[model samples]
Target: MALATVRFDAGQPVDLEDSLLGGQAHRWKRASHPELVEGEWYSGVLRGVLVLIRQHGQAIEFLSSSSDPQAMIPRIRDHLRLDDDLKAIQAEIAGDPNVAAQVERYPGLRVLRQDPWECLIAYICSANSNIETIHRNMERLSDEFGEPLTLPNPQGEGTGTITRNAFPKPVDLAEAGEAELRRLKLGFRAPYVHQAAIAVAERRLDLAHLVAAPYQEAKAELMALKGIGDKIADCIALMSLEKMEAFPIDVWVRRALADWYFPGQKTPTNRILLEWAQRYFGRYAGYANQYLFHGRRLRDRKPAQPESG
Candidate 1:
């Protein structure tokens, strides 16, 4: 079967590299196929559909598995948050000089609206783990339990097919149990993922309801689950629950707050910093957090210049 293509006009600048692979979502891979060059095309599974997308100037081009590619546009839009006014959001969080620099440095980075259950489990695996580890764990979980899918290679005739796995559902994970999850190298998070999956699968936790709940309420609900702390809860709220005011304070973000906002002062607690961030950035604190966190990490990775002779 041939894949359907659609060009979506986002009406704003979008950097697919920074937005999709910049740490918000872990499933996307830079396409290695000859027809889809690295950094030009990305392949990922979204809500069970295998999607290959590329940024075409201001518009986005997509090749998806859906029979009705037109109907999937709405979902694609929501996933990428194309309707968000990037300029307005940047202006809102640009009050701080450091944050302003990040906005200027990395344009078109938007928080993805992800599936609640998937986001929850992903973050649970994120505790004390780096991005690479998280990606490995999620991939392992999906490969083991997720539904298998095959798509005609983008090259078409005689090029064979590509295979991908949909992210596993809560019922799938719950049935696998913690023992099976441990084999995936989830480590300490194995039980937590298992328990959270069981809760969602059993309907003991209503992730869908939290999407409409207030930020605090949503954070509280997520924190009540095993292995979810303030930071992870805030991540779920900001990325999935539509809580832009939720500021997650990871080590990088905490360093940003200390080095930029609270310079020369005693470092405050995560709770205190979160309060100040929400008050300072108001409804767009989460956006500010992402920019600062990503910007700081990138800055630190750069090699220092030699001292003047």
Candidate 2:
């Protein structure tokens, strides 16, 4: 790796593993399966931005600006803002004694912050799918439509190609037919993807504003899209737009919540989970749900706990 310094102004705190791995951008190409250890630094692309992330064991380092890294360090140290308000969210979810116990068991878990555009399309593909399949489909989409970037081998081996740009703009996808996407093996998501791209390209839909809009309005607008349902709508609002109050209920969260609150009971429906989350977790409900989701998926069977105050 070249000796270059990078700077990052973390408008909000970032969790590399949770943010990158918990969703569609999981299958990163490396020269070798480098043994990731604490404080280990590696360079890769996240959401088309070149970043140098350090595995601090507990948390990851994110460099958003690739200018003088040494000079950027002090600025980032001074500018980075942790969302400690999540503690209040944790308390709200923890109001239920059992949920509190689970939260206590997995303290280091946090909500992932991803690029809004990528999160928008990625979660749209997430409907009725598994992580592994989502990863495969995302890779295929990149191979088919995403811009190409050459990457160096982390192990000092030969270079390789990985999707290096944002998911194609909606116009780009609108140029292709459903058959082309189907060829990428998107399965039933092909038409959905095509129409979404068309929607964005034709100015029929607006995705960026959802981030700043009120949660309810954002959810309503997202749901108005052809393929989006309630769950996917909430996902766009929460993950893409950074609406912390938006609670997205997927099968895993439903299972976790059911196990915690109604053991031996049938899995709760998405509607019920959403209502419960809004009532119990309040504004930070989305943050708490994210932590719980990552804890369950990435860290084996453990529940997410909060860091000590």
Candidate 3:
């Protein structure tokens, strides 16, 4: 297998851990923990390529299973959104007091530019689900239908080969009936997944055209899909289609807004919250959403301090 690698100085726009696990994408897995670096091995497949990445002090490194290793750099850069000026975006998002606190709390968090087709399906699984459920369902989809790929182990852990399934193409997934998908525990979303896969496989859902379209237009196109709603559309818009202004609101974001921004007012409608986010966070709302989301996850994971005695 062909092998390639890339590295970047630490504190760059990309934080592999935060960028992957920060609620934007759930398909990535923590492959191992090694002593050489102050980081862990992460493995993921995107657009038929398997990427194994890990970060150490002042440097992030990657190994890819693509034929042309260097060709993967552009994709990786785009995936991590390294081209964006994150420092500036952070300042812009910090306009909100709550998100400002998040900015100070989580410095390396970033929004990733994910593969659009996979991103859409992943978010479909996100509805009414926690991150753990999203991860399990997406993994099941890949394991059952997506192509299998093996990556070279730079760290030389187990057998020197790490295997994973690349996310299936629309055409492949289209062949899966909703009933079969339901068996994979997609539940009520089975039909929606089936329909979406069929639409893309049949060329009815043109993600390329949608990506080139205005943000709202692209959003409308995604919302036209079976299971996609305002939140899912914005998720795809921001992460996959390169619409930086898109802000997806989940219960966590809603709670944050209620507690921090709109105290005393009734819980705002989804439309109102979205409109308010657009106005408040402006063009980099996606980045702001990520920082806030990651911060919320961190807060939730924190162990409670002992009660004062």
Colliding pairs, model 1 = none
- The full ranking of all candidates by lDDT, starting with the best, is 1, 3, 2
Candidate 1 per-residue C-alpha lDDT over 189-237 given as tens digits, one digit per residue, 9 for 90 to 100: 9999999999999998998899899888888889999899999999999
lDDT of 2 by residue, 55-85 (tens): 4443435443334446545433321124444
The candidate 3 region of ten consecutive residues with least summed lDDT is 300-309
Which number leads on lDDT?
A: 1
RMSD of each: 4.4, 6.1, 4.7
Off by over 4 Å in 3: 1-5, 9-11, 33-39, 155-160, 301-309
Q: TM-score for each prediction?
A: 0.94, 0.76, 0.90
Worst 10 residues of 2 by lDDT: 300-309
lDDT of 3 by residue, 1-309 (tens): 234368765446556777787667888878763532224678788789988877775376887778787787778777777777888888877877888888787777888888889998988888777777788899999999988887665555553576789888888778989889999999988888889999999999998898889999999989998888998899889989989889888876776778777899898987899999888889888888777767765665433321100
Best TM-score among the predictions, by candidate number: 1
Give lDDT per model, in order: 0.84, 0.60, 0.79
Q: How far out, in Å, is residue 105 in model 1?
A: 0.9
